[model samples]
Target: MWALDSGICNSLEQPIKRCTAKVIAFDLETDKTVKTVDLSDILKPHSRPQYLVTDYSPNGFPYVYISDAEGAIIVLDIHHNKMYRVVLPRAISAGCGESDVLYLLLVRRPKNQNMVIFSYLCGNKVYGIKSEFLRTGRGSSAIVELGSKTKHSVLLGTDGSNGVILRYRSESELYKWNTDQPYKECNFELVQLAEECRLSTHVAPGGKDALMYSLSSNVADYLNHTCGAGGASARLKYISKECEDDCY
Candidate 1:
């Protein structure tokens, strides 16, 4: 089953006050429609329904979290046949995929300030953590640089149960696996190893899949030996140098 995004249907021809878009779910197996949710009253007219992200509830319910470009997250309770909205402090940029934990990654900045901040949404509330280690530069540039450096990052599997797992290319020219139990309030750490890798929390479950990098040089040697490239294979290309425009 998949969700369909019906873009702005002309309200001028229709007998309605506002333009309404519908999200419909189809049962591919039975070839029948399951449910239809109208988004006109809940979301603004200009909010494009093109890119929608879905997250299954970890609480073992049929509550599917649906988010769109306009920062609106609608929780559709399939069992209860009701829909509710999650109050977001700001537009969420990241969230868990396939995992049972309903964690959302949020990046916040103060108005007219030269600072970039990171926070997480768990248990229906936004919580800010100590991320001084992530502040590489001042102002928006810092966030931009961090985002650029970690652009090739991945969401590795969680820490066993109820934990967040992330893997990304670091600014230190090393591939690292960042793991933490954000829901449990545990200390997060970045490990210089890659045993498992996953996807970004901000992207859809089947969206852009991230490439997993192995930290061990032996893996590179093995690939080189098998392929007979001898030097600088695609595996080694995973390691990258810091950008020259780096503020720090």
Candidate 2:
């Protein structure tokens, strides 16, 4: 397993100090760290790094896409021990704050692992680019805007296949969209998983069987009524094959 350590701070209330951070590789069987990569020199001074493991290469090397405070993605090639920085277009990343850039999602295409899709939750469009282009820092024309529309809902996650999961603020059902489909066609609900509690969706790790899961909770009610007096009920559930078929 691999993990990123952003260093320590004085207290929980205080922000993390602008210190050097490390990416550690561990041997699960022996429970020992095998290697460590220092980010002090590669990362900009005082920049904060957020770890995001979304896809892997055809050769099976996991791509570690780290989002920094400056609205740029630091793509780490673990197998080759190489690193590259990816900056979004000015129209998409300009004037974006740390929190705004954190919402950008990167997912690899199931049909073609060499390609990657990038989307922002608040933005009306999605972009696609070949992974090779990012590695070589080549042609800007290689990055293409795949889709665009006046979006009203927020993106939840990917289906781990070709679909992008989304949901309205007031709805309980999840919707999906693919590159080939029109915006209005995305109204089809992938699942009606909850009615009362709020739901958070996640793509299964490693994209196994293209499965997706959700964690539903009534924490809003608990906070409003109990005021941190007790624990709120929650359930972890995966969307099964039967559920997926029924949606179609």
Candidate 3:
């Protein structure tokens, strides 16, 4: 029951009410209620709510985690309203594991049209994505979308920021940056309106909606590459034109 805003506490958006108070916690930065906890009607005692509940769901709803908040990691299930807590350091601007593997946060820099990729190591130390000093600046936002269970990348949307997102694959030559080439003419008029961007992939057999970063609403004008598990198998299939059995 962390109420930083004296205003929104009394509102109906919060998790619980007087007769059955069910709110697990509340974040101060993004003023909004986190309901649909993994647990129903269960309660836990905390020394202070303000000490936990960091930034959450600035854009997409129901995707939230309090790092090291629940003595581990706190997973609030939006669909069922249950709370599952896991112990992990919930840093504000980080979402990568030990290796530089997962896709870090990506933002665009307006100054020089560069990108910034925010990464984390050992799950605690925070790192920034840079490419030859052409990336990163202040007041930039970072968004990390998991490309797949084993692969992920940061989509740097903040213009002029040094958080460039680069894609990496196991057992293959790592790819360079994923910046939108200016000279390549876009085909759609709507894509021309987007201020920032994030590229996500999905599987058609899995209904295409269950893929990584599937919660995103933007799916136009970007290269939609199919991801495969186990690099060698994916490559062998690609060489044989048998990609459909895996990709689709």
lDDT for model 2, on a 0 to 1 scale? Answer: 0.59
lDDT of 3 by residue, 1-248 (tens): 33222111443344343333233445557766653232222324431111122222323334233222122323344443445533223453245432222223333445433232333222233233222121111121332222222243322222123212222221111122333432111310111111123222210112244221111222332223322231211111111122232432
Compared to the true structure, candidate 3 yields what TM-score? Answer: 0.22
lDDT of 1 by residue, 21-48 (tens): 6677788889999877776666664443
Residue-level lDDT of model 2, residues 118-178, one tens digit each, is 5554556656667666665663457787766464455566665556666654455666666
Which has the greatest lDDT? 2
Whole-model Cα lDDT of every candidate shown, in order: 0.36, 0.59, 0.28
Error of 3 at 129 (Å): 17
Global CA lDDT of candidate 3, please?
A: 0.28
TM-score ranking of the models: 2, 1, 3
Ranking by lDDT: 2, 1, 3
- Lowest summed lDDT across 10 adjacent residues in model 1 is found at 130-139
Instruction: Please say which candidate is ahead in TM-score: 1 or 2.
Output: 2
